[model samples]
Target: MGILVQEDKGLFHLQSAGMSYILQLVNDYPAHVYWGKKLRSGSNLEGLLNLGGNRGLDRLPQEYPQYGTGDFRTPAYQVRLEDGTRITELKYSGYRVVEGKPSLPGLPSVYVESAQEAQTLELTLKDDYAKLSVILRYTVFEHTNVITRSVEFTNAGETQLRLQRALSASVDFSSGDMDMIYLAGAWSREGNLTRRRLVQGGTTIGSRRGMSSHQLNPFAALVKPETDENHGEAYGFSLVYSGGFEAEAEVDSFGMTRFTMGLNSFDFAWLLEPGEQFQTPEVVMVYSSEGIGEMSRTYHRLYRTRLCRGLYRDKERPILVNNWEATYFNFDADKLESIAAEGAKLGIELFVLDDGWFGKRDADNSSLGDWVEDLRKLPGGLSDVAQRVNNLGLQFGLWFEPEMISPDSELYRKHPDWCLHVPGRRRSEARWQLVLDYTREDVRQYIYESLSRIFSTVPISYVKWDMNRCLTEIGSAELPSERQGETAHRYVLGLYELLERITSEFPHILFESCCSGGGRFDPGMLHYMPQTWTSDDTDAVERLKIQYGTSLVYPVSSIGAHVSAVPNHQVGRITPLSFRGDVAMSGNFGYELDLTKFTDEEKELVKEQVANYKQIRSLVQQGNLYRLQSPFEGNETAWMFVSDDQREALVYYFRVMAVPHPPRRSLKLNGLNPELDYILEASGEVYGGDRLMQAGLALPDIQQDFVSGCYKLKVQE
Candidate 1:
């Protein structure tokens, strides 16, 4: 489960628990040999590199193909030399293997707690005439069938160079007979599963919104045409970046496919001076021979433990009650207190005062960048209100859109050029807000200082860092004209910097990232913020698909799901409270509605829901997930969570719109110990694990629309 080098044959084999990736230096050019099931030790890997015979560079499966160098496919990178030529060749110069994975500079990547857990391979390629050196890094962990890849480019020459397109990683498959699956949607409908067969041309998915747009995620998977959740081979690619990104799957004339993922080259360029270097973000690749389910579990575990950090990474998230949907911009100190008091009576642990607490901000159109408390709403200020909420035996949280500015704000009035803009053009507006030019050091410093001030005095326990809009009129005021194209990427880097400072300073605060809900719910944000608001659409019927699709790449712990009032604020669907609670409990459970407005009967039901969640949240947050049915395939959705020791499990099933005169159905569970006997907690019925898995457990008759059920199982000792 480590890297093996056949130095004589110029072959490098990176092996994980269940997969292997082999590449060979053929004539000083690295060519991909095999990437699939693990091969036996001392396998004839050299012969595999020559299986297709001596072919042109265009046809060979290259580890990192170049443009204008015999190969005609998309280059892994393109650089504009001093002489204005975009052609360059990189030949093998040297290589080294290390015991630990090295962190990428100023970037967020999966980390290793100990050096013995993973092995890294650094292969150096040099363009002698251009004086360019590129280092391709690959790391394989001992316990997972996952390999991460990234690239670093250094200008070793005395002359300056320009990087036009620098993608992180690429892979070529021998055959194009596969299906490409990705997550796509917009706003409230984020993370909808979309799958299509590979064609002769290229199929691309990306985000150019200066943020990882909700329209498409920075992830994709390719599987055989016959692959399903439980069977067949699947190769997954995910970019560990939050800004504009592109993932492409290209099929050539001879039925060969090449997949690439990294920063979007659109309006992107970097200037590398002599002795300077540029490091691209990391791309995580997973090879799952057991199917898409296994691939998803690999990603979920890796990101949940290694990528997400801080105090809350492994802890069970508190059941929070956010006041955004309840009061919006109209809440006063009294209104917030009432909600907190009612939530405390029920089992909610945290009360979040969302939006409208700053400046004269009565609505979304004003007072974004101004962080001062609105004294008119709270006569004593934020400290007083936070103390009042804390006195109710609940933790207090605040919401901030630190990266946005309202045109009517004092900060914007003082510095009109603070927002992203072009000199001659009128700035565009979304949600009546403009994105702050984070590329400017002054802007980031001001935001940091402003947030730090509040963090020091407010006794705040959690923060909802919200960005309501995307980047527009993308020009930074501090950058020179020649570096204007670097605005978007620089902005992302600045965001990471600010996040690192703020999160590090206040390590105890639980931060959740939101972009009008689920817009920026990528792995990059999860590095600093452990969880993300799954979506703005709190309708249980809608969340059935949203949560289900999100589980493909993100862990259940990283999803912030909430029970909102009905008709839901976004979808206006009138779903039952129990149905909403069942759906929301699958994630970091919370409530987004006004608890003070609940009737006595409703209050009792909420209490029960909260208690039940408290009992099972540990298993839900850290257990292995097994999806039995997909909402995309039918009206019914079923999923389960199993403890690591296989002694306990939780099963949830939902019927969106119950069919009339439906046939009896039973769900077959997975990830259970077939050798043990289990007891159902609710009915006290005993059944063997083999019977529950093979013969299945009968589902109850739910005749109403939007109904759900939960079953808990414990192994009989």
Candidate 2:
């Protein structure tokens, strides 16, 4: 069933894949009744409400929790009027069902390639008191257990409407027992999975750092108290936004749970003039009755195919070698060519030159805005180096922090007003660089053209778009004083516009977004760029947790994992070369090291890693992943990936720190056909799929810290 509307009972039931969501109108107000397994047709709605021995205001599920309904729970969506009023009420007005999904203007959203691929439900709720209207839009894909939700506000009344808090979607559950799972960390240690019980009262996670921040990601999962990778019910919400966002999970006094998500309310105020409308970003909702594993796979399939678009979306990315930790800012043409020559000999496909390419920029403190090449470093110019790398049989890639400007740069010297700064206040600087006020048309055009000029000079195949700092003096000269609150949101809009124009123009270029490495790794950025640098910490042991935590929601194809030199650049924890290579292979494999200095043995190992990865790139990038053992629970972590057709599988096992006479732990594999027989590539041993999954494969003995093993299993024909 797609979307069924019962006009007689004033109910809307949406069914997609194997799940169903039910919404009904009670006294003209929209209320959510059931959102779980597919229900039988003509099921009694009253029985699903679970009113707790009451049938009035206290028990009704408030779809848009309002102050006038005696629902003390936080209102789902909020706004204010120019007449100084925040007391608002919304009642269901009308709704319509459409064929295909509609794109959010100037925003990154999932698109339906065909009318038969998806169906949409647009429900209109009008606030008669403020003469404002709210459109609740939901799109259900025919073949995916995913329902995308967004809100649109239109000023239909006589006066201007100011929106202080307009959340995208909200759902209420009569049960209070659930566990909240989220990813939280800082800088190089991003995407650390954290789980806690959803107790009484409210728990909110968000980012006010302007660029989704490094502190918290814009996704959260609520599951049954006993939920795990293999069992129990789970509900996940991921906001399709790159900028600041807010997710609130609150439990009311009656032990009911409510989850709401949207743009962060802090420094966010939108003024909607009469006859104008504003659309909030989309929040993807997924339900899984089997467990969190099924929920994650649904997200992976939806985002990898629908959300991430471009030349690299379905194609396997070329193995790259980046010169960041290798030379930092102290590399010249000769030095870069030496590294590229070694990489080419080792089968690396791309070479990326990072930073210090232009304008007296030997360090991070200067030349951020100067896109021109420094003759002293390049001798002839960047074109010479690009051509040289091309002759070495490697595609050339370059890094640019185009959103920032140094105070001593030529561009900043000419246009001091271009940076974001409050009129009379001192501008705060991070990394000795100031953020550009992208809200200004002049600033956006200048930066866009500057980048275009660089791409025109060389046959660059990739660009690492990096933003090294956050917004400090968050003010824009283009916006008036009264509308300064709109700067943050408008800045995000400007960024999207710039990205859209550039990505569309240079469709051949492979763009990888890195905000201090994984800071801005959200769905919105993935919508423009296919992959993001997972993190800056290349330590093999640390990456075990980072990659595992990131894989909770994001697919392996969208993560940028690299093998860096040791003693590790970030943590000083040097491990075995093979261990590092194994961890990096879990994502878009690459190397971040000075290959020219590698020992003969290490060079051979690098070549072997590259060769091995190519043989199984598609299996790792486009396979069904199963998280076997959690690193959060023990010293050992294990994961496996089965090819889509179930003909092959790869299993990875890692031991962070070895213990004396440790207990043996068996990893039960998932996503395999029990009736098939499989052969071990390394051992020439054959076993039935059912035996491999039920009896399980025992881990090899762990002899040292930071050690790992990889197993390849093939179905016996």
Candidate 3:
């Protein structure tokens, strides 16, 4: 259970029963080539702080050249351990270059980058040795979840070194069974308004391959750079930054997987002459039972369970209907109030005024962060509309993109340098807009102050925090030379910190993340928001694919779905109102369509659907889910749910295509109390469970239907 020591390498960890892991570390790495620590670990790890195991290296000098810090205080190397229950690792972050220490040419003779220096003061420098690149002490808590690893690279000596940064980790994936050979791909893209991409199966969906690495299990790494000649090599997604760095991420991996995250983009060498400070990219791996969606859900749980226990978990989510797909940058406040009045009549929760509320946001090209109410459209201040809705028994919600500014807006004119732009370099204008850098505390403060004023003044129940673009041409002319690449990493961290502060101060207001639909749909955002808009696509048919893919990991409660009108604004496909209600039932359900346009009967249907949702919210939100047939399988897909008590179950079978002829009997169900009598109440039609569930029983089967009417099963004890 403990580490043993030797003279050369500081420590050797021994595996023990139920021990879960063996991590050997040599704290002082003589050199500073950060990208390839794994290949260099066995030779460079030289510092010593062993837990209980023997030091594997030949004993070296206390201030030996072998055990020393490099130019930047980045994490040296790492070993990851995980079971279904727990994931843990030992790693280090902060490293400062000290003067007069052991120097390596222009590098420091000896350096110190301890876990304590990084402000993770809770960690103990349990073990270290001279092995690979500089290996050393780290906290066991770092790898406990989806957080990967973080290394702070401080310029210790007086001279700046070439910053060719690439961050990676090593994992011993000794699986008890055959390792699930998964093809590594990234749905990730930088936040640049000018660029957008999707990569699946290690190949970019529409363009050339983005960054991804090929793993040889705990060993070789074949990097598929953006400039790689071979376009089809199966590899893990790797993003290389040849310039200034910035960005924060929570990584997750399976079997011998290293969720390597880093910020590159630093084309020029950092000019850290002396007394200059900087930090390497931070990588944290979060754990989730499912995949990407759960990866995001875990972040939310961490915020709730770990960080903000005092913060009440918001139970009453805002029931705001968006006007994006309903009216799409059209309609005035009077028109909005008419719709809000109708929503209030249905016990509809909140009335939200979506986009087109601000300056020239009409066609998605301008008015991103122009918070002023569009007088041309609204004819009245936004608060007038909010007050009107509040009086009508509905809470009001507003949309804002404070992190972005359009060229057509007043904010961009005053502070043109506020964005992440470099002088003389062409900047990307995604959707004809740019992301305002929040890396600067001033920018962060501006957003905080502006939104706080609006929210505090009004009875706003929710705010849709939307990020419509990704980063391209990332460079902050505001930062110093050594810390320039820091914009990306720092920007992301700044965002997290900003959200933390804002949410902490205003705990009652709900924030829903809207990243150009679902682009920012990850654990990172969930840490700040109660729910995310499932996708920008309000089309019910497209939503099925988007929501189905989203649900593989995330709880249905975290997904935000709406019943929008068809010729679905995104994908022109009109579906039944009943079907829309059924699909939206799984998540935080609401409707986005203009209710004023619906008939009296349809309004009554909305009322009925709302009531039905409340009755089964417990079942749909907190039940064991099973996919009897995959949506990707065939013309029809079936899914079932059983409550924790095992008494009630609901099955949904949808046939996308009509069958020429249908069978007379329904398919037999499973996971029921086999010996108990049952009853089926489907669409208010009741049938005895024992008779309906009997094998070969002749029962009425609706010829393959897409209407997700429930087939309820109640089992008697």
Candidate 3 — worst ten consecutive residues by lDDT sum? 208-217
The candidate that wins on lDDT is 1
For candidate 3, write residues 1-717 as lDDT tens digits: 222223344333221211112233345322111221112224433332222454222221121121123211122222111111111122332232222112122110011233321112111221122111222222222222322233333334433333344342322211212112112222221111111121211211111111111101011122222312122111222111111222211111211112223443334233333344334433333333233322333333333333222232435344466766667787888888888888888878787788788776778877666676778887767778888988898888888877787887788888888788888988789788887887788888888887888877878878888776776666776787556755665566677668878877887778887766655554445546757776666665555555655554345556788898866766577787888877777667888878988989899999888877777766665565554444544565555667656688877655555566665636555445555565565544444445444561233455544555557677644
Cα shift from native, residue 703, model 1 (Å): 1.6
lDDT of 2 by residue, 1-717 (tens): 788888888888888878888888878878888888888668786456655565666567776666555667777666788878787888889999999899999889988888888899999999888998989999988787789999999999888888888888889888889889999999988889999898899989999999898899999999998888989999999998988899989987778899989999888888888998999999999999989888888888888999988888899899999998899989889999999999999999999999899889998899888889999889978899999999999999999998999998999999999998998999888999999998988999999989999887789999999999999889988888777888988898999999999999999999999999889999999999999998888888888888888888898899999999989988898798999999999899999999988999999999999999999889899888899888878887888889888879999988878788877867778888899999989999997889889988877776787878888999998
Model 2 clash number: 0
> What is the Cα-based lDDT of residue 568 in candidate 2?
93
Over the full model, what C-alpha lDDT does candidate 3 score relative to the true structure?
0.50
Using lDDT as the yardstick, the better of models 1 and 3 is 1
Model 1 alpha-carbon miss at residue 83, Å = 1.5
lDDT values for all models: 0.93, 0.89, 0.50
Give Cα distance to truth, residue 487, candidate 2, Å. 0.7
TM-score of candidate 2 to 2 decimals? 0.98
Best by TM-score: 1
